[model samples]
Target: MRHLLVRLATVLAGVTVLAAPTAASVNLDVAGFGPAHHALAGHGVGYNINGYNWGGYAATGSGFTSVSATWTTPSATCNSRSDLYAPWVGLDGYGSSSVEQTGVATDCSSGRAVNEPWYEMYPAAPVYLSTSSYPVAAGNVIHASVTYAGGSSFTLTLTNQSRGWTYTTTKSLSGARRSSAEVIIESPPGRYPNFGTISFTGSTVNGSSLSSFNPVALDPSNGVYEAHTGALSGGNFSITYQHE
Candidate 1:
């Protein structure tokens, strides 16, 4: 009877793994948003790196089922190179590999500011979804959400509330660690775009506010770029670019 019970448990575990949704593989061309610059002095709830500054819960458990945030589009300056910055919410990729995220990229190309909606599953390049169906612009109120659909599937939704436009897509992902949920301002791996001050309001992970978790300041080992995070109050926070 004991051996039969052990075999049954093993079979159940196998069934659970096989039942998980399988994510479609995507080609990732963009550079990974890993550790870059450092956080600015007196900013950020937790963790600071040279290229990324974020605020959120940093724990290892079942991971976050959903993450969402609302932010006003900030002005961007590329200086000389086509610099880039993004405000995003996602699961994992903080202390582990694999990240599932969606947000708006405010880029400075040829001294002009361009904003658009995009989603990414780490190990794959970001996929831009903005077009005539969902247009984005500066000063628009953007709300982005990433919800886990169990297993390797998740749904990403981005809305330009100011323009009354929304873009949503459901994708399956593989190799997701689901370690942490985050609200971040990132200067992707190549050029350091001047992302002007941006405010993020109503930040939530798994239905709970950011203030509910013990936030930490995450910074890169090498201090190159500089950004700051405002205090978390009422689940709202702001991240400002200090230098790039």
Candidate 2:
């Protein structure tokens, strides 16, 4: 069962699709720690690196010795970077991080599945899609935004791949629209910086439809905002963009 769970976790976490090469270098800093408007504590730059999403985090010890950490995938492409981006210390006040995964598709008929990435957070913060519950069902588009009081404005659009599902409006920074994206059951690899899904109906470079689907797992046990935790907190996150 242990091995089975590991496989399940690997499949659910979407670890198989992170083998692509990255387009740029990821840099993580630890000296300039920022404040916590998002609570949870952790901050830094976030983006895709070498086809794998990474987030860096660093925290000062009570007395001395500070701890700096980088959240990344177990793939060779990500683990073997020389200029690997490290986590950094956050500055005072509010801060934010955002990463985008584009060009997603799936060819189910051929039994070939491509990972469709989505941002997710652990500890499950109750999300609402247009005044409804979480997991904005299919056929609805939700406009999502995040702000850190004194921090920057973070926004993204979510389209439900499924139908008749919606998140509540009260959960949105701008109660007017909910996050929208076509939600698929294909769980992509990588970590969830925040909990949620972004639907994609586009074709890949080879002309394949996006069919990855996931039921949306809310992991509350893991609270530290690591790159793979699907939760966003205070941490240094990196992203190396790629197109193939």
Task: State which candidate has the highest lDDT.
Answer: 1
lDDT of 2 by residue, 121-193 (tens): 2111112122233332222332222222222222222333343332211111222111111111111233232
Worst 10 residues of 2 by lDDT: 26-35
Off by over 4 Å in 1: 1-61, 219-222
Candidate 2 off by > 4 Å: 1-50, 54-138, 150-244
Candidate 1 to truth, TM: 0.75
